[model samples]
Target: MIDSPKPTSLKAVMETLNAQEAAKPSSGLTSKEKRARTVARLVLVQALYQMELTGTGVETVIREFSDHRFEGDLEGEKLADADEAFFGEGARAIVKEQATIDRLITDRLAAGWRIERLDTTVRAILRSGAWELKFRPDVAVEVVINEYVEIARAFYGETEARFVNGALDGIAKDTRG
Candidate 1:
């Protein structure tokens, strides 16, 4: 039997809770790889949000995830192994280019809406999804939107999922269309 790693601290609880599983049909990737990437995206959003709230740096957050959270199992459910490279790239690149990313998102938002007005979770999803659409040309735009929509739905509800879809779709259209 796989041994779930013991909880090291309250931080571990946050990490596990933040990265609850998401839903996405296969996007030409093997199941294992797909799950890993999904987990990576979820983790990146959570990590970025945490950094924003706590005023932590990317390197510190990445180190904390790599050394403490990713390897451990929470309760009976194991933390799915995520794509480390992708996680690092998403977390670092999004923050590194946040102004540009936000600009892209802001330009796409509906007339009355603003990024700052979004809930922290929604903003995190939008930023991470925007980063993938803008920079990760290796991933198809549809897949990018689908993955993030699923994550938003998982964390929130149908409305948030639709909001994410609209925002990311606009980004893809402006950038990739």
Candidate 2:
């Protein structure tokens, strides 16, 4: 169990998270909308990975996802419907500005650690996180870092999540500050 104000079972944890989200007064987004966006980000990273591995074009990948992918389970877990418009827009924008996004990520990576040297999943995470940092000014830097770090945790352990956090934090400093 994670450190928290009170120890919680896995089931209660969702309620706790929902309560916490409800307490955030600054957010105009409803919890369902926020969940959909989070799902969208997860799906977006997968789409990016697929495009890289299969040499698929952006439109084709986006269309494929919209038509056949988003409504179903992901990795055995039930997922909320992804924000399809957000997913498509983000994928297109990222591909369009990928060179710049790659450069931003490459610069944040440690010396001797090239963007291409990273695991493909990590690369996808960094690319999408970097794109959001540079392009999505409406999202707070902390939210971007936290969301991507959570995505990293889904695929890896604490160490990779920390690496993603540091990399995105660096990118945020350069792009958001």
Candidate 3:
């Protein structure tokens, strides 16, 4: 399990991302690595959003994103190769097994609400949590759920945090089963 970064506030993560975004080409990281990290973050965010919005297969979305869309964002020969590789692999795996993940989430839902009807932020958090649980199980499930719940609290609110926690706990159980 990827040891979750010590519990930093969501504001810190976003600030870090923003700093990375604003970093000059001359900064410590090679432009390529910087670009890659940016791309990876973007893809991660997009995948979570898309899964909630469309419930589409992850493979299809990733293929389309990689083959066509990903290229347009880069200008020269120097592209974010590492970011592309990491993001592509991670997104593909998560999307490929999304249905199974969603099923796990559905199984854990409270009475009266279905997975489809949940708010997009809640759903996105679940997708991220499921991805971590399934693909990055080396990272403790509690860490994954907690980090995502923080993300939910940052972007949404306490209500969404409860929903995210419930969904992730359900997913962890289902993945274990």
Best by TM-score: 2
Candidate 3 on 1-177: residue-level lDDT in tens?
Answer: 111122224435444444634653344556555545544544465565775467666676667666765665322322234366666666776667878777777777777778888766566567667877877666566556655665666566677778777777777777755
- TM values, all candidates: 0.81, 0.86, 0.58
TM-score of 1: 0.81
lDDT of 3 at 7: 22
Q: Rate the local accuracy (lDDT) of all candidates.
A: 0.76, 0.77, 0.60
| TM-score ranking of the models | 2, 1, 3
Error of 1 at 13 (Å): 19
| RMSD (Å) of each candidate, 1 decimal | 7.1, 6.5, 9.2
Estimate the lDDT of model 3: 0.60
Which should have the higher lDDT, number 1 or number 3?
1
- Once all C-alphas are superposed, what RMSD does model 3 give against the true structure? 9.2
lDDT of 2 by residue, 1-66 (tens): 011111112223234344555666656687887766777877888888888888889999888877
Q: Tell me how many residue pairs clash in candidate 2.
A: 0
Scored by lDDT, model 1 comes in at 0.76
What tens-digit string does per-residue lDDT give for candidate 1 at 63-123?
9888877886434334457788899989999988999999999998878988899887789
Off by over 4 Å in 1: 1-28, 74-77
Distance (Å) between predicted and true CA of 119, model 1?
0.6
